[model samples]
Target chain A: MADVKDVDWDAVMADSRFQSLRRKKTIFLWVLMVFSMTYYFVLPLGAAYFPHVFQIKIWGVLNVGLLFALSQFVVAWAVAFCYERRASGQFDVLAKEIVVAFHQQEPRR
Target chain B: MRASRAWSSVILCVISVLVALMPNVALADATVIGGEWRALTLTVFAAVIGLTIYVTYRSASHVKSAADFYAASGSISGLQNGWAIAGDYLSAASFLGIAGLIALNGYDGFMYSVGFLVAYVTVLLVIAEPCRNIGQYTLADILAYRNDPKLSRIFGALSVITVSTFYLTAQMVGGGVLVKTLIGIDYEVSVIAVGVLMLGYVIFGGMVATTWVQIIKATLLVIASIVLVMLVWVPYGFSLPDFMADVVGDPKVQARVAALLGDSSTVMTPSELGQRFLEPGLLYKMPVDQISLAMALVFGTAGLPHILMRFFTVHDAQQARKSVLWAMAIIGGFYVLTLILGFGAAHLVGPAAISAVDAGGNMAAPLLAQYLGGGRDSFWGNFMLAFVSAVAFATIVAVVAGLVLAAASAMAHDLYVGVLRAGRQVSSGQQVAAARVATLIVGAMAILIGIAAKGQNVAVLVGLAFAVAASANFPCILLTLYWRRANTAGMVAGMVVGTLVAVGLTLVSPNLTYPLQKIAAANKVLDAEQAKRTAIEAVLQNPWPQSESLIVKARAEQVALDKAIRLAQADIKKYEGQSRSFMGLKEPLISLKNPGVISIPAGFLAAILASLWIRDERARAKWSELYVRQNTGMGISKSVSH
Candidate 1:
């Protein structure tokens, strides 16, 4: 194994494929994180401050708070599924291309 | 005495078998052994344990190399690894504690489940694939990869050991409580038994055995939960409303609720009962603690060594990503059913019965199982109890094994091989041996501490473990992967500050400190009363007194009694007010039961601020390479058999 300092990281970072992949993943993760955190924080905050509203029954025997809590499970799965599809379909292709380009530029000794 | 002894033996046999079938039960008495349930429970328990041990024996042969020992040679597929991850993550705390909490406190308990399940999204989006792409064996590998390996190794090892040990203690305590309650054994004995079994699995079978055990346990727990839900649902015509109505209408349950509201004569309407159960504020009277707990749980999952290590068992980063989704699906479904189980126990068994069994309500699930089966002495009742208990037991064993493996790897692989040997060319065989020895040492420490911590609430310790993990380990991992400027000094400072603040706050938090003060106050009151009684006795010359002197003494005694009663009432009021405060302070230094709200940001700030001062160009340059590799999975090590 060679020292990591020897790798041409500047060239790799400059590659359009690497930059594109990084941007897509970062944006997707941040959006999903903010959405999930907001959704989660709302339950306790709502129950604490506006509990009477949360206690109002939306469906037979199901209240606003219970519905809100249960929706989080579905939302979490949907986000994960979307991320998986995006990664395997689009990101993987770009990643493979970058790997191939790097190897071609500096062939392993 | 002879009759009672005979009855006890009969109960023991059934309990032992049920103990084999299920690992936890909160209350056991003479009535538990009255019928065919005992025989059925025993038989099922035996079969479960037999199957578990057999799986361990079968997997032992494949663990011939260090890679195999640490990661099952990355032979596990995504789906299998997902179930294994669930098995590893869901401990007695989730299965018993959450359900019990919901039974006692309504909506507040279910909040814990929501926080726990949502945490996986963070794992799926940010940590999973990147962690899998970067390292092997333990979390320390990734932390040390780009920076100074020696310093990273030291900090990583310390954090991993600290988090794992805290988690281990919680699981061991749960195990002891389960064994004592179900099998009627001493708490110390139960702790030692669980510790020894955990050591056996790690020392002999390694990750192969551990993974299989987890997979089996997870499957069993899910199945048991589904069965319990069905049983509870069927009688209520599969309508949640009907089931809840029955719970609200039960005379005993109604009485319990009236007592909770401080009005014995109160008769609550159906809507009011529903409102109380569905809304918060029953358990978390102060709302800040609720949000703080959620913060700890959400960020905490990313830092737990055992959970993080599971990603390595799969083949690649893609599988790692897939595994998190699969885990979320299974775990999410199981939590949904916990509502049914919790409410069912509260309705069918009643709060009085639950408290009689265990004040913590940890036995709600198992007791509910027995009720659903056909009451305590019926064949179905015994069988259901045994099965649930077996699954709960498996839950404890699987979680503890994972924690021990993570801690031992940190001790042997990171500290012994990486730092002490300076990454020397030690044989894989020798490394495997060192890990086994470390497992024994770690296991022994957990057992001793667990014995010492007997009867302490399991929930508090579990929460503290999450806070520590989130504060200390989460920031270092995130910064190391993302920020280019983060150096050895920043990582060390973040870990030290985060760990000290979290642990220090927990020690002084109302949960631990207030209880000690209350006990001390009670002892002082008792001593004062004893001294007063002695003085009164010494003042009297003879056993019998004249009427005039007796009347005079009685009047004085009445005055003292009134004074004492007033003092006691004041003490009770003061203690209630100070229950959530620190050291008789008007307001607590750490207001929240969980310290994550403050500690997590403290960690990130410390890391970022410290990094700004120390510029390491080498580490900064290394970041691009780490980022490229982390994103693209290029030049990452493929799983190789030694």
Candidate 2:
């Protein structure tokens, strides 16, 4: 096991790179979660309570509920795509620095 | 290891030889495939089986260690593992069942697709990377990483076994249903066949075979869906709007919609049918049931044993995250295609035809394929039908193999190694052998359950499995990762309570209880008729009550007859359009079809409260270490070393 005492965990946790990565990831995840949850739950909740709204035809043979459900696929893919971009482009850089520092200290231990 | 490898090769050779020799006998029973494409389907199925066996044979040689058996030595690339994850996730339930649901029920079925896809957000953001970092072979590794290893492993293994068994049964039952419908085999035989094949894959080839099989099946499924969508699109001038317009105008579709709306007398217009089809309330009439279903699906995917196990197959946490994204992309695309195939079946094949084939509309996709290719007796039609059936078969095999592997790992890695051995040094060969034995046992159990559960609603079984998974496993895993004070007691309490509530609620809920009540009512009526006849015969033969007493007795008999008729009439009325409720009750006690919304929170609460009652400082202290390891993917080497 990697030595817990070899590198100061508290110092690592307080590192600026780690903190920023956590903040950005947490914010993005929360935003996507809220958005997707609202978008998803609205159909079932609306179907139960205000099903009439879903009957409102937005286009020929298309209504609010079907359109909304279809849009969710788009929304999910978007969330995944955006998360991947940020994780690889931004978060990985910070994570790699921490790993490198740990590795550099590992030989001494 | 050498002995096992040789044994696996022998098994593969026997299977291959049997497959080669058995096709002729299977083809002679041409009535099984409706006599049109029997030979073609048998050939294709044999070829598919042969290909999987070859893959298994190749993979068997690489099973020199437990790590190789469980996670393929972490050699699968992010992209390949991503496809495998999608393959593992999209069981027969999603591939054929969802499309069938959409074709029959319309807009409400699409809700399942949305919930399933949106679930990846939870997996990717919260579970995937951390789970990959902390765990080696099974999910138990992660849960046991910080707490009392034995207790945590036991609870984790129990939950894994429970979830996987439920899921495996569902997949096995689905396979039986599909084969029975497609190839006209006995349900029991079909179930046994699927069981044997899945057992062979896991026992001999392990994760290596399972992953490749999944990738192959996923690719075929996606391609088949896309081709079906295109076939559907061509009929409407390649325009979705045009297709909807055509569907709205089609007389057959309008009639089907009117019938579904329970207003055939009114003769719904084309526009009205279109509006109803696009709107909700077709299948999921109750909002609460819909909400609960959504909850179960969204959370359930995160807790599925086979799916969680896939994260370990990737090289690192980053690869795991990437794989989740790739799975989302593939799954999202497939769901979108389902929209087309579903609507196409409704428009082209018509609901009456779909219902005629299978009341639950599970045959809609295959029937659509047949229709698109040509008529049922035509070569194109038969070939398309065979291809679709082959794909569905592959889908079932892939999913069941994954489930068996997960269950086996739980038994071998968590139960035997972590608990029984008490962290003792066991050879990798011994561990691999144990996993194979566990796979065989699990596979046998699944087959027996599948045979027993023949003709039961496969969709409800799958839903209940998801509800159990969401309730029992999701809460415990989530809390274990995020909640520092979570102890062994908390984990055990949460899982046990969650499993009990989810299962208990489902058993007493309207889904099962209502149908059972109907059967009882039917039997009661028959018994009452027999008793009434016997009473008349007794009165005629003996006439026990004489004179005034006889008069009173006759009156009493008359009253009894009148009451019986009235009760029967009431039962008939009550069960005319809906299932009979318990004791002729007007409404069920618990109305939600899925118990996730209630059980999930209950589980989390149980875990938290239990932890509050019994705090563990050492576990709490380890949280920082786990957190750091989870975030940066550090210290995973130590955990993976075992």
Each model's iRMS: 2.0, 1.8
* DockQ for all models: 0.55, 0.63
Residue B105 alpha-carbon offset, candidate 1, angstroms: 1.2
The lDDT per prediction is 0.77, 0.78
Put down candidate 1 lDDT per residue, B518-595, tens digits, no spaces: 645655655677665655555455466645434334334434444555566565665664544334543336556888
Q: What is the lDDT of residue B483 in candidate 2?
A: 70
Error of 2 at B198 (Å): 1.0
Question: What TM-score would every model get versus the actual structure?
Answer: 0.86, 0.87
Q: Which ranges in model 1 have alpha carbons more than 4 Å from their true place?
A: A1-7, A105-109, B1-39, B263-271, B513-589, B638-642
lDDT of 1 at B380: 81
- Candidate 1 local lDDT, A1-109, one digit each (tens): 3433345777789888788888987887788889988988888788788888877787666678777888878887888888888888988888889877776664334
The candidate scoring highest on DockQ is 2
How close to the true structure is residue B114 of candidate 2, measured as C-alpha lDDT?
82
Best lDDT goes to which candidate? 2
Question: Per-residue lDDT tens digits of candidate 2, residues B585-618?
Answer: 5446787788888988888888888878987776
